[model samples]
Target: MEMVRELASKKAAVIFTKSSCCMCHSIKALFYELGASPTVHELDQDANGREIEWALRSLGCNPAVPAVFIGGQFVGSAKDVISLHLDGSLKQMLINAKAIWF
Candidate 1:
């Protein structure tokens, strides 16, 4: 989401994703299409990648493939991100997160 992008602009970001996840790929592509690049941390490739997975589990998140974060704040899954973008809420979230100027 916008908040995630803002945090990423300020510092390196970690998007915990899985290689086999379609939604995860979509999220990455969305960022690319928007001219935002996030350092993806594929969970299926590393055990520590499960940290976010565990957090999501604790937060009652579905055992999904894309659990994003910004400045250590959980930003939900790909659907949530895309939905925000569609609703124009992501822009403010990004501004509030300080990822975009204007």
Candidate 2:
């Protein structure tokens, strides 16, 4: 949990993901399209992946991977991110977090 907190706060935007997940890739692409650079942690490649996933579960994230955090706040999962984007609020969220200039 400490590590999750640290990573979340370390960047304006962070994404906890698994390398081969298509939804994870889509989320990354979305952020890129929005001109926001998010710090991505590929759990599949990390030694503490299971522990981090466990921590995320404790935080109420189901399926854990592709969890998005903005400004140290757990924003949501891939579906939530897509919903926010479609609703036109994701850009503002990124701006608020200072993750994007615009």
Candidate 3:
């Protein structure tokens, strides 16, 4: 949990992902398209991956990989991200989180 919190607070936008997960790829692409350079943690390749995943689950994330955190807050899964984007709130969220300058 401490590691997860540290990583989350290390950047304005952070994503815990697995390399082979398509949803993770989609989310990464989404941040790129939005002009935000998010810090990505590839769980599959990390020594503490499983621990972090479990920590994320305890924090209320389901299927934890691809878990998104902005401004130290859990932003949910791909569905939630898409919804925020479609609703035009994602941009502001990024700005508020200090993830993007524009």
Give the winner by TM-score: 2
Model 1 worst lDDT run, 10 consecutive residues: 4-13
Deviation in angstroms for 52 in model 2?
A: 0.2
On residues 4-102, what C-alpha lDDT tens digit does candidate 2 reach at each position? Answer: 999999999999999999999999999999999999999999999999999999998898989999999999999999999999999999999999995
Estimate the TM-score for candidate 1: 0.71
* Overall local distance difference test of candidate 1: 0.65
For candidate 1, lDDT tens digit of each residue in 25-57? Answer: 998887656545567878789765566467556
- How far residue 37's Cα lies from its native spot in candidate 1, in Å, is 1.5
Q: What does each candidate score in C-alpha RMSD?
A: 5.1, 0.7, 0.8
* Global local distance difference test of model 2: 0.95
Model 2 pairs whose backbones collide: none
> Which ranges of candidate 1 are over 4 A from the true structure?
1-13, 98-102
Worst lDDT run of 10 residues, candidate 2, spans: 57-66
Task: Write candidate 3's Cα lDDT for 1-102 as tens digits.
Answer: 999999998899999999999999999999999999999999999999999999999987788878999998889888889899999998899999989986
Answer with 2 or 3, whichever has the higher TM-score.
Answer: 2
Pairs of residues at least 3 apart in sequence or in different chains that clash in candidate 1: 2-94, 6-99
Clash numbers, per candidate: 2, 0, 0
